[model samples]
Target: MGDVVRAPWDAYFATGFDTCSEVLRGRNWLAPDFAWQERQADTERWEAVATQEMTKTLSRLNAPEHTCQRRSLGNLFDRSTVQRLTPQVEEHVTRLLDELADKLRWGEADFVSTVSEQLPISTIGSWLGIPPEDYPHILEITHNQVHAQELLPTKEQLAVSAEATVQLRAYFTEMVRRRRERPGNDVLTGWIHTWDAREPDRERADEILYRLTMFVTIASLETTATLLSAMVELLLREPGQWKWLAEHPGHIDSAVDEVLRYDPPIHINTRIAAEDTVLAGVPIAKDSMVHVLYGAANHDPRRNENPDTFDIRRTGTHLTFGGGVHYCLGAALARMEARTLLTQLLKRFPTLRTVSPAVYAPRLVFRRVTSLGVAV
Candidate 1:
């Protein structure tokens, strides 16, 4: 355990294994505090509708509301549900791999765009009841939302993303309405049924729909894409690991976990202290902005020996998925996606190698390579 380190912008960063773990499990809000909000507002960076709705999202909510939302929607992503959907996942994986094979035959292919990005969107889009035609629109919005959060985005980029957020809310709002009128055989319909049956008022019904839908669309696609891309980059960089995987298919799960630990898709999880608390012997003041560096925490030496090494056989839990009540609801879904894709990738393209230099995205909270050129 270590003392919390103060950062430049009135922010506190909790590092090490125990410190960050405690902060995540403690009373905290995923959303920034009033001070941070004021700073964003002062700079005209705050999108009111997006900010407010995101606060109610599954990851941001606390207490009975979070519990209720989690329980109501939990079945949609339960073990049995994911198992039932395995064939669908396999279908997407096979199609994407086939496409990649074609691209690879033509010399080189951008793995991130061709495979890492499309699979999650197609799989999650189908689950969300999004029409195939609407995926382009939704993917555009997700890209805008993700890019707008860069370490140093331009003013114009912020404006564009704000508009995208508004559009995303509206899109979901209408989607929820349609689902209500003629419920479908998809996850959104299940969510609509759960929310409407519990909260009948039309306005609250709409609110529930918009928030959850937005959260799911962004969270599922972006983080999983990042994970997939990073996994490919890491494995390809260490060709030995690739050969090892091809030889020992049983280690695929460990490889996924190792990739998660080595370069977690989500690097930093922002939390605001709800009340005065002590984390790992560090006194945290109320309303303090605490950055639980999951990336750092996962790599903490205390938590894992030789933390810097990318060893699939390494043993220990990692905080790639946060701890306690807010642990990722999509953990299983993400794991399945990575496992299916990586297993198929190793089996199909055992000799796949990078054809171009890796280029990383300019973002701190998330880790993603902009493009990964590869060939067999």
Candidate 2:
């Protein structure tokens, strides 16, 4: 067993499969309380404005609110919704891949920008009825905001992030107004229907819709973008496996799940101890910060027979989307997006291979490759 890695703020890292699972699934630890109003309150900076506001999102909400939001919006992400989105996803994947065909033949092309980054933003943004023209600006704003959210960000960094957050809030506020006036078949419209059902004046509905929209639009892009690069990188590491997948297209489903398990986009999920409890015999004081290392637990030998090996046929589930109440809300869409793009990519260019070493973005909470060059 490894020793506990503690941060300056007294946060504890739980890397063991059993320990992490227990902490994540049990009621001992809870999501962020969102009670803090300022960023730099104590000696060590425990939060940033970006993170502080993010705490108010569905992922970080406590009990009743979390349950209400999840239930009301759960059907929108069900398998059927994903199936319905398949054709649109395919069109985008095809268009993006076609754009890269000429560039890849030169034996090198930055797939991260050309494919990985574009696919998610385009697909998710289009699905939500975000205007085609606004996507680039939105991605840029979110990128800046996400990077500025360092544990100990500089004064300048915080200032920039605060501005970006303001821009995002305004963009979503206007978008929500438009969607409410002219409803359609997209997710925003569906959410509008749910809220419009009970709320008469639309005050509560507008607040809820705006928050959910801002959070989902930004968070959704991060995962799918990273997962696209990570999955391709992992498969090409074992060319034989990539070839195997190309031959047996039916394995795409398992392939996507395995990628999520092997190299999850989000590495750590935090939970505050609700009450004093013992996790794997270690005492965790009430209100202590617990970091559940999903990436580590995913590869724990005890949990999987050969955790290091990236086998598409690996059975059971991983903590990639997490577990219990906080499981990733967009899990279905992420899987579908990855599976769709990879399946089509391999079929179109069976000889596609990574040409350069992957370069990861500098971030603590996310595992995103900033650049990955590939050749066909």
Candidate 3:
């Protein structure tokens, strides 16, 4: 396929590194926010509760709103914060590895369920002061919630996503209320105070805090789990790289970046043209939607040498966390989690091996690996 092509469904697909990067970083491109959704012909699709809830998130907002909200929470994932959280990440990794060791003694253990899924929820939940008892429910709802984010969700999937969105809202609303009743020195409580102080309207503050809590939980869970599992799976698949990493533990950072570039958790991102634009000599009209394929672009030979090869030594850049104003706020935290997990995991189980190939769910935009069995 050419770098830019029109899909049969009328959306433009930007698959090359240059084209995708331009669309992502260009000022003329915008996320499909609420206003854009309202302008679409499919009223019923845009009217779904899940769709509406998603458009309100930090990722979907444009310009001034996005700028303001992002600035408010900017320090949450800064280098110092992530560095301060490293010890806690190490503690969680150690605990999870100990549990995995017990399971390995019996037979092959599912790394996905036992370690990958647990670490992220444990870390973020503790940070947000959420009780450990609630993680299982959060994980379930988060998984169901992403169906609506799929490239082409079915009617049934949309309904499931809508229901999940409702459950999440109710859960976070209660959590925010409890935090107000019994304040703690946690991220959620801090946000509550910040929002309340800035906005005199109590109801509006609560609403913003509720959405922030829900978004942080949903954003951190599945995607980080996928990253953790993918790192382990890829390393084990290439025994030499696995052994090399075990010895040269200092290269963990590079290894993490390589894994992100080779197999990102999110493959596609959608953006709309704010005005008439020409991409690679092709004219795109205003309000046209373009699906930027990060996965395809990451493998573009023009951007990196031996693009298909997973070489941790190569210093390569990727669109995994996106670009421009909508760059991922949790990038630093996610990197810290992966690095800590990999370092501790290798130190504990250098002989770890994948007993079976990863089994992924039927997803296009988000890569969801349902199972990855491993033996130590």
Candidate 4:
């Protein structure tokens, strides 16, 4: 409505919520696959997303408590909490790199299939207590969710999502139950303490946890992994960026941030207007769907200088993590993952190279790599 133009509320109101409308209205377009009290978690779509679902899911979990749940377990985002968690992340990145370096016996290897995917899933999965073997299955769910309409997930996709949800809920429910019985140092255990016995909607707590887990799992998966891969891919393509990063290692953090803006893992966000509104002087009626193009916003000449360049030194602001109350909560984790993974790549595989002919994610929403073959 202001700095960013949300979906066309009136257009959404006119066409109603559907695949196309969801893309257009961006605001509150519920996932049709799964049912939520608010935006129903689209089971089919979630299944197809592989990764984007994760990024989107996490965003929803951390969304305002008042709207979705009376209470949310977003303490994971507090600056103090992030600071405390950084060390563990650093260790994980280092260990992951060492593990990769150990496997580089062959002269050449596909880094994307090997190192890039391993870092985020391993780290994020460990945080949530999910076994590494489960990464592929969960990732598949995320892929399905994001690409549901295209893959046209038949009844089979819905069936898989349903069965998977049951399995996941059973797992989390048992996990939550055990944590409540005898809590541990894990975040889930801590979350159980605050999330226990959601009085008004006791029954909904299960769904809440389900959605919450989806949020953490899906959000971090795409942003962190994709961004990490994108960074390494770019360095290989430009080559010079590697020299700049190596010479000015101190700038890696800022470089990661710039890359996020220059080639954001997420390109557009869909929002459905809560009511009638006008955006960028364009009049929109109630319930219109709006597509917030963060990629475009980051490059908006009005807000930035030389928006086309990928200068790590460039600063100001961008909606890479979005804006306003519903902004991404795991931005810190995403940043940490990207920075750490990038650092590990430079150190362990200084001569890392991409296989080339990489493909852009076929979606109009989040921007990411569908396939990027790289060497280690």
Q: Taking the tens digit of each residue's C-alpha lDDT, what string does model 3 give over 99-174?
A: 9999999999999999999999999998998889999999999999999888888899999999999999999999
Tell me how candidate 2 scores on lDDT: 0.81
Top of the candidates by lDDT: 3
Clashing pairs in 2: none
Instruction: Name the runs in model 3 displaced over 4 angstroms.
Output: none
Worst 10 residues of 2 by lDDT: 35-44
Reference-based lDDT, each prediction: 0.80, 0.81, 0.90, 0.59
**Candidate 4 residue spans exceeding 4 A from truth:** 1-71, 148-171, 197-202
Cα error, candidate 3, residue 344 (Å): 0.8
Point out where model 2 deviates above 4 Å.
2-8, 36-47, 148-157
Candidate 1: pairs in clash: none
Return the TM-score for each candidate structure: 0.92, 0.92, 0.98, 0.76
**Error of model 3, residue 139, in angstroms:** 0.2
Runs in model 1 lying further than 4 Å from the true structure: 1-3, 28-49, 147-154
Please report the TM-score between candidate 1 and the true structure.
0.92
Candidate 2: count the clashes: 0
lDDT of 1 by residue, 1-376 (tens): 3547887876788888788888777655444533446554254444444444455678666677778877877655788888987899999999999999998888999998898889888988888878878877887787777655553457776667778888888898888888888977877877777787899796987787778887878888878988998888888887588998889999889989998999888888778877777766677777677888887888888889889998888776799989888888788999999999998999999899998866777778766677889998
Task: State model 3's lDDT.
Answer: 0.90
